[model samples]
Target chain A: MLIRKPNPIRSSEITSKDNYLNRREFIRAGAASGAIAGASLSAPAALAAVIPDEPLAKLADIRKPSPFSTDETLTSYDDVTTYNNFYEFGTGKDDPHRNARDFEPQPWSIKVDGHAENTGTFHLEDFVKPHTLEERIYRMRCVEAWSMVIPWVGIPLADVLKALKPTSKAKFVAFETLYDPKRMPGQRRRVLDWPYREGLTIAEAMHPLTILAVGLYGEVLPNQNGAPLRLVVPWKYGFKGIKSIVRIRFMSRMPQTSWNLSAPHEYGFYANVNPEVDHPRWSQARERRIGSGLFAAKQPTLMFNGYAEEVASLYDGLDLRRNY
Target chain B: MNINTRIRYVLKPLVFVLALLPAAFVVTDLFEITGRLGANPVEEILDRFGNWGLRFMMLALAVTPLRRVTGLAWIARFRRMIGLFAFFYIAMHFAVWLVLDQGLYLPGIGEDIAKRPFITIGMLALVLLTAMALTSTAGMRRRLGKRWNQLHTSAYAVGILGVWHYWWQVKADILEPLIYAVILSALLGHRLWHRRARSQGVTPRLRANQGAG
Candidate 1:
């Protein structure tokens, strides 16, 4: 139901040539011309006021918010969050967003702890607002075996980590999602071990590819997709990139994540998207692009999602199969 | 005699046709989801088919309670056929997922279930259904006897698993799966309660000293 609304920001920003009104128009023009697609999001910041909120809203927003943005990026909450990654909400590619409206995002604060110099209870908005939204086109591969190209608006994880610098011994990063039985009814049942937990190697956490994204397409993150904030690691299986984050922990040892602990043989911490390492029941040779038909052609799964130039060094010399 | 024979004749075909419905819906929906149906339309189709599978499985589990309440003993006759159809559509769901969607590749399917918990539970439900179907024949039922009953009891487990698999897969919306869960749980609960009462129905009395007399 929520997925049908046209993006609010797109509706407002695409109204006209109002230079002082918004920056989105300029960004759109820039991206259209292939000039500066990944640069600023709107028309040079000079054209927003003149453009009324007609075609788009000021902010747009979903599953796995990208850390990058361009005119091609989605810029509305309806498009962004309503299209999400929460598994309990349902498993259709877009089901989470459609079903996640009731999840109240306010009264939200994440517990920040574990091997950190700066430790305290942080309100979700306080953490989310400080960062400028940059749109990065990311390759999202769900463990459920589908893929999508998402343009997200978020700050680097490095930046977030910098603020809450971990102690020297912090060798891994772990996050927990909200586990309330009332809101997250799925947690009430034992499908997984209640609240979801996911972790990453320290180097993977520090990689430029890792992001603590706030918005996607162009709006604030939607509830189904882990509203307000979630992690984006383009190199790992989607599960390694957890959702609905409520806690951030830095530890010396690898965190025993929900999936890994649930079934160790199947889900390893180094769940890099490797085609060579076969899961017990199925192979990871290829992925079905989400928009494609069920019988649509399959695309070969790339190591580190073809981001090896960016992330392979993180696992240098380590056998991904064993780690996986 | 006429009444009894007529009831059997009608019930025989009804079970067969009711059993085919799940398979029919899944196959038709797979085609719809695969064809150029719009995104929302395809999503609706996939979702509805899944619902039907769940509903039919619940319906099959409803047999005992339904038979007790309505005194329609013939309803019990349909349970196996309905169960097999439940497994059949579940197989279709797997095929759509592995063959058509994932191209029958193992890694993609694993990654999917591994990455997505919903897929994991969904696959588990399918696995349970498959096991139940494999042991569904009269031969296996007789060979295993009590174990067969214990094994087929997994139908309840599979049905619950199906509800959860469907429920968790949704991201934001949840009303539909929740409703299905309630109905299945109620039906299963009735069977459980009934069985518990039946097992305690008669306590053995001590044979008094009347043996000598």
Candidate 2:
């Protein structure tokens, strides 16, 4: 005998005329409120939505905003990540965002060798474990006359160099980005010499502000924004901050930077942001802030990108115009 | 109405609208109705204007060659309009760079034009285009007489300079500029080939109003 109980479908679940009308009205009200919320918090909400869903547990402790942060509004994370000049990805501004989706950044290793006491290839996780990550909100000025305020998460390069114990002969620190033609389609083009390289003088590398960044905006760094590890020298042009670093070599002589090798006259090893000296192609006296609306006025570029008090003394005796 | 009359009345106005469309699109994008300009709107605007300017320059240069090949004399009538539109876009590009990018910094603009190789070449092309546009009127053409043809012939040089400016400006991924270079080379090559053939007394069949003046 089938003693089938009545199905336990709730009245709310059933599409009754009164309930259906009420549900539609509720949905309409909800959508209207959402539109209002979106309009009011345009920048931050848009940024939050675009931040990739990666394991951000490493950033748990270092998520607080830094004291060193500028009062200037931070550029949205979407703009910082999507609009990049990582030519290894491609030349187009949005190329890195579109092309680097499948890039394998996890399970990465960095080879730390050449003129260092502790010269060995180490897992990226192991390298990052020792240091206390700190948040640094920095004004990133590009040689192309654009700028952004980035929230970077990493230990200072000075601290990392201290661990390595660079030999006295190590006068410069040379960094190399990963070279995988299959992963990086732009590598097939002869736009730059393969294995993009950059170097900083030992003094510059040891500067307190110089960071070996691993994350941004309270998340694991996006692949386009140099996942795993990268150098961030806020006082210099954005290109000086090499991305996707795989090798860190301590060289005795000034190492050849990628752009300097390609166009020596135009791009110098010391790419410090200077308004007085202009790139032959354009003036550097002003810069358009990224993520600012089209009609927004260009801001006057500060000397050393407003890090003049800290970094200007680094070049006190040196002739910037001549070096530039 | 006759074919010539139909082209002058209808086709000419249509071509004018087509020529003006790119600029109109840029304006609409500026208003954010169509968020086509992306994050860096100033750069996008500058780039789009420059692109249209270069494209119009190519079209203007293609007219004579296309007319000769197709035996369509009416095509030659749109050349002045196309050339003027090219100048218009280039001027807008320069204006945006000056006002929006440079913030009306006259000295900086001067320095860039004087110092930068790419800017120098681009300014030279603009100067040539301006001269051609000013002399485009029938009265001015008669006033300059034979010299008018001589001045207008510099459009070939303008085309080369325009392409060179584009090539020099790019940091990498030069495929776009390379395409322009190839097209310019082909157009110029056709002229050279035809000249050589004519010199050899081969009297090509498409010879109608092919005189240098």
Candidate 3:
């Protein structure tokens, strides 16, 4: 007889409905405590002090241990939140954590347009309310040859797109991050044009593996991790996972992506995890898993980040080397 | 004590301590004494050493201009130490990439140096730095004579390559690398200006600085 061990993180750790409702109160309390923290430490440290201590609004009714989930050791919640590539906040891995402390992802809305029947702005809550949330533990491969396994809580993009009623002409889906420089300090610099944009083919967008994540590790998404909503394409490089989404448009043509626009030769439209196709300066053959200690050797990178079985057919005849 | 004695005792040790701080900080961070290296400690360590190496190279190059401007010949005494520290930090950076990052994967290391332009340039700089470091002693300086000065002129080439290596590695937002490029340009331009001035017999003061340059 096999003995099944209980998982460390479960529904018991999820926030109660009352705690979820009192999120604003918690934020207000956080702000007050942040002010007190400011007196002792420097400005950035003060902001950082408030974040790890405060309880995030934990997501409810998350269906975990899904068939789609990976059985990998989860990256610590602190590492997941702190080390990020949300260029909207800043370019440095730690910059987002430090700078996005005061970012208000609350009262957010997303605008749906172009080749879709649902063509108006809707509150983020309304967009999320319809579907059953799932916990997808995926291997997130960065273009910089770093990897992480994150437990994301989100609804399938296919389910959300079905409600939007995309037309036959909708061959691609383009997503845009919020462009407010006041909140997103990095937006002021024109790093890769003001509003960072990413796109996916209609087929890739509708894949069950693709999700629009609203939370991570059973908690509401932190500001640094793209609060409210963000795209999560498990098979693609992390840059394809656009953060802090404000506008999502269905289009006839392949949409322009920010990194591709920045350097067309280096970054391409189809940013799949292909170990064979090397970046201009670095090898994509291997990735250093984050939180794997200092001396660990980089593991060999997998095709489509080990989701080739699920996503390879989407690009049946396409040359990933050329597309990448 | 006389000024030379004071310089030898007080200034040299102070400069040594100041130069060693970056390495000290890395060791402390590696041990997580202050817990400041963030999530990826190896990357932080690697980047910090590389950044300081470039900074020290800049400092080594700046010594001539500083001595020329300030007329403080004692500053020249620190140049050798500074140049050696630059080598030390750069060697640390390369060691980290080889041992910790690549895990002594010889084939991968060779591929990166041969294929990648940035790594190729960085490797060239390291080779030049190694040659210079080998011949840095006073005995080697006397034995090589005129060839010593000729070989050391490659320092400028190393400076340019270091900056270029940094510029190529950056994904986007070239602000930091751009700043390094600008400083290198200034240092190179200063040398060109002084050399031109010395050739034309423009100023006696300028000609006096040629020995150090």
Candidate 4:
């Protein structure tokens, strides 16, 4: 597999490294966008309006954009949080937003094991703190032909994988989501083989663009938005970015993903966002951006979700149409 | 006039208004006044219209069985109206999908109807419904005479295709579509049971009237 060097200087040139590191300055910097400003100012008020007496104090801190972030306009906090397809929660778009309200994201632990030197169950906080957090504004395209541009706050998956020190036998990385059927009501029904799973080639997992996101729109990850931890593979379809992650296993072979297992002919293992290759059910040539309202025309989908320049080399001569 | 005549006069207009309400809600949602369409309004609109189309089809199918069960002959009068309304909603659903969703892209819409199994079934339902709708008028019914009933019987096939289309489109959470399937089966079952009973010479009051007439 071909490996490409991540550009470290990209973030440094975008903003003053010192100011970007300071949480306060970062919040101020992010306030320029109308969506982020409205989100930061109104989140507490909105939450308060819903639950009049409860004090959600932690919501007051706004997230600042990292130097590595994209310049795309951010989708509104309402659209991002409300319109979700987290099948582990439910199949309806708003089911996750409604059902995940009582889900407890705290007291979380992630197991990092299989073909790795640093193999152990670690507390979510300890595992996250050692790496620098960055806000990457990415275009998330779903296999359902809908898309969203979200400002996600998290550490790169490469940083985490490098810390784990994978052995030579680790040819692929597989992820598993939490499986408590009681907490996750959708799991009660076998919508997907429970404990939703996803996988990537070793090279794809180590790509600089792959992130283990913990938050969106600057607040702590909402329960519905895969609270505590989630993967954000910008180049692939949104299902590849599994949510509420609990385990990461490095294996010698490509692991079966939830959708691919359910319908192999429709959903492929690679799942790279290629517009030319249509899903058996629907066309992927264009996608309707969430929150763009009813009258707006659809935007054409980009190859590898517009990250082709960075990650295309990984699939050098492979036929994307067949692999899809 | 008697109370029955008074009710009959008001019922048609009331049902007409009631049938138009779903379309009105869709229009308000399209304008974003109610904001019920949520993030993906096109999908929401398409889904709502399709849902109403299926619901109207079910209501149309229920008319014959309901009239026989209740022994209310007046209920049979509204059957054509309800069936026409079903055609209206399905047409709206197809229009939104073709014009708004597909952006008037004829080739793509044709390809979808021709290729995708669910879309193919849905289009078949629409075509069957259109034929029923066209032959529904009093003039056309008079001209075709006995053949009209045979053509309209295709509505049963339309209902089956509709429910199947709904069942096939969903990725998971088959609960809603499954409910529709059960209701449709019960409706179809009632017709079959009655037909069997009539064939066995066990004529109920309603069947006796048809036999005598």
lDDT of 2 by residue, A1-324 (tens): 222223222333566744664565456446555754675585444322222236343365573466666767889977898898888788899999889888878777677768998765566765665576788999999999999999898888998898989999999999989888888888888788767889999999999889989888877888898887999999999999999898898999998788887778789999999998888677788899998776677888998889898888888799999887
Evaluated with TM-score, which candidate comes out highest?
3
Pairwise DockQ winner, candidates 2 and 3 = 3
Q: Which residue runs of candidate 3 sit more than 4 Å off their true CA positions?
A: A1-55, B204-212
Question: Residue-wise lDDT of candidate 3 within A1-324, one digit each (tens)?
Answer: 222224312432566733543464456456556555665475343333211223367676678788999999999998998998887788899999889999888777677878998655566755775677899999999999999999998999999999999999999999988888899998888677757789999999999999999888888888899887899999999999999898888999998788888888999999999999999999999999999998899999999999999999999999887889
Q: How do these models rank on DockQ, best leading?
A: 3, 2, 4, 1
Query: In terms of lDDT, which candidate is strongest?
Result: 3
| DockQ for all candidate structures vs. native | 0.17, 0.45, 0.65, 0.36
Give the candidates in order of lDDT, highest first.
Answer: 3, 2, 4, 1
DockQ of 2: 0.45
Indicate whether candidate 3 or candidate 4 has the larger TM-score.
3
Model 2 residue B115 lDDT?
A: 88
Reference-based TM-score, model 1: 0.60
Local lDDT at B40 for model 3 = 80
Q: What is the DockQ of candidate 4?
A: 0.36
